[model samples]
Target chain A: MAENPMEQFEVFKIGPSLLLNGTNVSLTNSSLFMIISVFLIILFFALGTRKLNIIPGKIQVLNELVFDFISKMINDTAGLDAKPYFSFILTLFLFILSLNMVGLFPYSFTVTSQIIVTFALATIIFIGVTIVGFIKNGVGFLKIFVPSGIPVFLLPLIIVIEIISYLSRPISLSVRLFANMLAGHTMLKVFGGFVVALGIYVGWLPLSFSIALIALEILVAFLQAYVFAVLSCIYLNDALHMHH
Target chain B: MKKILVVALFLLSISQGTYAKEGMPQLNPEFWIAQIFWLIITFFLLFFLIQKFFTPKILFTIEQRKNLISNLIKDSEDYKNKISVLENEYNQIITQAKKQAIDESLLLKVELNKRINEKKKKLADQLNIETEKVEKEIDDFKKKTLDNLPEIAGNFSTEIIEKIIGAKPNASNLKAIISEITDQEKKSRYV
Candidate 1:
């Protein structure tokens, strides 16, 4: 049998140990790529807007397209009151999107495929939005757990359910991105193994399937990033407006 | 260049851990803390970089470009309005000038006609006085000639008889004959 397809997700440490409070906080390939993604993002924006000309070049145009897209997404979902959070939302979007795209490369490790990474990100957003909720609405933020127009008999049950769902926000958000990346990449690896093992004689079928899967995976990568950002915006909106 | 340096530094930092470890290291509890540690560092670094530096500059450029476009449009509109106002004012002045010119021409024509009629009336009066004077002079000349006709005829007949018959005719008889002839000529001319 061919090598296991699941082996692609293996995380190996990249650098020597730097003992941080007795934890193995040594740099890993995941961290390397994350840093690389951040670098590329900064480079893209810095160079794109360096000229600042009235008539935009290709890089500036691409930069503007992304800028406008995220801005519009925030404005549409979160309303004008959420304008203060524009930088945070935009940064979150660009970071994840860059990581997702970088992950698509062969022999590369996808950081978002790790549950810890996505959960960390989701948790950050959840905590931040919760803080914002409290700060903006004070005690009234707790009212989100209680549905209006519910019968007194069902109030306790519905509120419990609502709170549970609210708490599960980070898990669902993180798992959604992690699972999609993991499955899509795994399937592609499996198909790649088939192409190699079967050779040229019967490999064409699996090769074609791999091509289709790659295309779909690219789309999923972009879509997952979009879903992540949009959901965060919606959560922030809930906090800002306290809308049910 | 700075971005490339940052990427290179990151690569250098992580280059030491490319060693093969057994099984899926992602599931290994030994690596989770490290992964989370790196995740926090990377996420926040990127977030601050973008938020503080990249986002503001890009949005500023876009906004500046938009403001430029709107200002250009506004300036062109103002110019158009000014041109239209000037054009309307020019047209009004031209119409007023044309109306004034026409009024002046009409007045001049009325004044010239009045002057010509007055001159024509004065000429007619002068001509009537001169014609009356000439008519009275002609009446006096006719009266004086009629009164001298009998004497002038008696003298001329006496002279003519002496010359023709070698004898002078009687003055009174010739006078009577001349008077009778002149009376008959006068009756023929007058009646």
Candidate 2:
């Protein structure tokens, strides 16, 4: 029998460990590619916006399209005051999106498929938003956890529930991305295995399904990035406006 | 700070336990460190490029367009005011020209009337002089004719008498003829 369909997700170490005081510290393929993706994103944007001319060239046009798109997104979701966050949000989106797309390549790891990576990103956003809330509102930041209009008697319980809800944000944010990428990739692999196992006559069906799923996965990759950025904007809006 | 420390300790313990699990792949700390390093690098680079290059250019273009529009508006307003002033000046010149023409015509009429009156006065003076001269000439011719009238009557009577009596009249008859001629002249003058 062929290997289990899910076994492809296993991580294997391929290099010697660099010992620092007898502790193993080493880089992996995943780390290497993550760094490479960041480098590429930086290079692309650097070259794209180098010449800021009146008439946009091809690269400049692409850059403007992305800039306009993100600016509009933040404006629509968080209002005009959110203009300050446009660059950060755009960068976050592009980085995540490119990582997701590169993950789709053969023999490459999906960094977001791992919980640690997604959790790390989500943690940064959560902490950043919380800091923004405190910085903007001072002691009034606690008001986010204690919504308005609740009776004094019910305030404590409600505040606790709100805190729990707030704490769950990172988990939900990370899991949503990780689960979608993991499930979609696993299914694609399973379908691909079926195409090889079954004869070419019956294999065409799974092959076609794989193709369709790949297309859907590509769309989902872009959508997940958009969702992540938009949610961050919403969180930032709550921080800035305290609209909870 | 305490929360961060607690979270770090908790993560470290969890990682240690997970590392002890048989057949499980080791979690590489360097991987995360590398990711964090790249993340900071990329974020700052992008932020600087956008802040320094892209944003300023866009804002400059927008400002330039605004200045251009304002200049055009100012120029148009100036043109409108100039046109209004020019129109007013044009009307003023036309009115002045009309007034000048009316004044010139009035002056010409006054000059023409004065010339006519002076000519009529000169003609009247010349006519009075001519009438006086003509009256003098007529009176002189009348006097000359009246003086010659006695001689002409005497000759006529002499011829008549020669024919009737076959001889010239004597001094007494001549005196009587002279007296009759004198009486007739007196009667014509009185009448």
Candidate 3:
């Protein structure tokens, strides 16, 4: 096992490296796991829903349950008008969730733990939502940053604050997911290292703690994914309806 | 606490790349482009696939299931309504048949009673005519016997005299004797 808990987060180039536009485009463990997660999601939905019996089988039940869960979540958060983008939001949630869960396995790479990957996803959402806002509401979309019914003197300050908060969305969104996964995995590795280093006689405490942490981390994984999806929905709602 | 210190030292030393070739590979700028590129490729491909194919398929299945259930319920309701209607018709038919049978029987009973009374009246009239004819025949026989009474009494006196003095009696006397005998018989029978 690697000595440093941080060592688990390292990305290593897997096949031959390629350079495009003066940037290295080499495939890495992160990409490999991302592909795996995508493949698993496809397989799950494809095979699970193939039969579509009136009385669903186990995998079919799981498929319907997940579908309904995301559907209801998006509907509640983004309203009925945002229904067209359900697939995109659901894909984002499943991809992140699968990546997080995959990271829990020993010797597995967590794609979401990388700031670059999360930032890329968050940036896409941010840019897409902004474009949607402009397209849907035209100049009225800018109203989101302006506070209504404020004292004349306080308008500028409040607008600046709102703009800052709006612009910081991508940063907060990306960092929250990346940091949660990175820190949780690191803690698990560190505690696990303790159990091994302390030996079996007195290591039971740390081992138990590691076990409990794993459970909590799993819960955290699910929660972070839910939070990420729900926040995206809220942003979409804002764009679609221009709620201040 | 000692374990925590050791773990912290290891993390710090790893970042320095003292023992490993890469410090923190997430910060190792060489792989960021590739990661983002692949992330985009995978995410959009997933998004398109789900949107175009999978989501629609599941939605269709759910729709089909709902329609199937509703149709079944509707068919059962139709069948229930149809059965009730048939039952109502059956009851109506049964009641109508019973009423018609009663009406027919009443008509038949009235016709039968009229026919019986007509036959009884004709038989009573025939019986009265036959009884009058029989009384007339009895009265004619009784008058013929009464007309022969004078001769029968003359003969009976002649027979008694011949037996006593060998001679006959007069016709008028015979007639008087017959009248006297008939009057005495009438007085004995009627009184």
How do the residues A18-125 of candidate 1 rate in per-residue lDDT, one tens digit apiece? 789888988988888899998898899878978877789889999889989988999999999988898888888888889999999998889888777888899999
Candidate of highest lDDT: 3
Candidate 3: deviation at residue A33, Å? 0.7
TM-score attained by model 2 = 0.62
The best candidate by DockQ is 3
For residues B28-122, could you state the per-residue lDDT of candidate 3 as single tens digits?
66688899989999999999899998899888888889999999999999999999999999999999999999999999999999999999999
Over A29-121, each residue of candidate 2 has an lDDT whose tens digit, in order, gives: 655566667777766766765765555678766776787788889988888877777667877788788878888887777776655677788
C-alpha lDDT of candidate 2 relative to the true structure: 0.74
Alpha carbon deviation, residue A75, candidate 2 (Å):
0.9
True contacts kept of each: 0.65, 0.12, 0.73
What is the CAPRI rating of model 3's predicted complex? acceptable
| Candidate 1, B1-191: lDDT as tens digits | 43344335334534644422443334455678888898888888878887788788888889888999999999999999999999999999999999999999999999999999999999999999998998888878777788788988888888899999999898888888999999998899899
DockQ of 3: 0.30
